[model samples]
Target: MCQLLGMNCNTPTDILFSFEGFHRRGGLTDHHADGWGIAFFEGRGCRLFLDDKPSADSPVAALVRAYPIQSENVIAHIRKATVGPVGLANTHPFIREMWGQYWIFAHNGDLKDYHPAPGQYFRPVGSTDSEAAFCAIMENLRQRWDAPPPLHELWEEVQSLTESIRAHGIFNFMLSNGEFLFAHCSTHLHYIVRKAPFTTAHLLDEDVTVDFANVTKPDDRVAVIATQPLTDNEHWTRIEPQQLILFKDGQPLYCS
Candidate 1:
């Protein structure tokens, strides 16, 4: 299994604060350390970064730390090499095109002996079950619609697709199409929402602290989801096992 970090906000926000603690988990705090990637969505486009090296030690990560790329939606992953060989292609937060928009995906669990039927519209570029599952979902969606459907309808379909794959094994994952963010927790996941009257939060992995109230606007709202809570002082609610939540404008629009 790997680790996942996602952010959805009402306005564009930089992930540097959360990423600081998360990157350390690749080799310093937790030792997943195989490959890592991150994607930030700006309108219809995405800025993606990937590396086969440990995120903590990867030279690519230095640029990530320096660049304050802001986005309304973001996804990141650090691999632990469960099924795929270490390489850039195997790094996660995989991206694909669908319905004239880009989609980003990342998984944090293992599917035992899972294999998917070949898809005409989408296929895994890498040999990991995570990517296979992603392609499967994309293929299924493409089969169901020629164009983008309503958010509510698409959300239900995505939820159903995820439920079908849950039988294979642990299936915690995050998906986004820039407009909405979906998170499914098969085992463990936690999320925190920061907004008006924000408070100071301290990273559990690093010796850094941020006073969010001082840095953010009064109306800014951001939802941060991770395999584990990144901050020690904030009250992060654990997403119940097997529950799927859809977030929009930094709010949980639906949960099931």
Candidate 2:
């Protein structure tokens, strides 16, 4: 299985600090090193980077660590290659255009014998079950609505679609359309919301510490979701095994 990391903030924020620790899971701390990718959503567009190399050793990953790219919504993944071959196209954090919006998806689990019907509007370019499932969701959305629907309606549709997919196998995943982030827990997932009165935090996988209060404003709020906790000091809320949550403006709008 792979691993997922996502961030949704009320204001644009850089993920370099969190990713600095998360990327180590690619090969150093863990073994999900088949490939890796990330997407940062800015306004109506997205900045995507993918590499068929371990994030722990890839030069591209190092650049990402050094660059402070700010985004409102972000999704990242380190793949272990259960379904797709070890290649660029098989990297996680797959992206596609839907209703003129860029949607990013990343999965952390495997599907068994799952083959969905081809969609007319949305389809997968990569041969991964995660991408195929994403395409299926988009295709369903395209067929159901001509334009972007309300966030609540979209959440309902996504919840139903995730339930259907979960029937096949583990379906832990994170999705975003640059507006809101959706996370579903199949086995393992945790999150933490940081806001005013922030404190120093230390990474569990690395000897790194950051005092967020010194660097962030009083009104800044950020929600980070991951397959596992990234830090050792702060408390992370563990999501239930079968749950779907929608995060907007760095807060959980809905959970079911």
Clashes of 2: 0
212-255 per-residue lDDT for model 2 (tens digits): 99989999999999999999999999999889999999989999
lDDT, candidate 1, 74-192, per-residue tens: 99999999888888788898999999989999998899878999899999998999999999999999999999998899889998999899999999999999988999999989999
Model 1 / residue 247 / CA error / Å:
1.1
lDDT of each: 0.92, 0.92
Candidate 2 weakest ten by summed lDDT: 89-98
Clashes of 1: 0
TM-score of predicted structure 1: 0.98
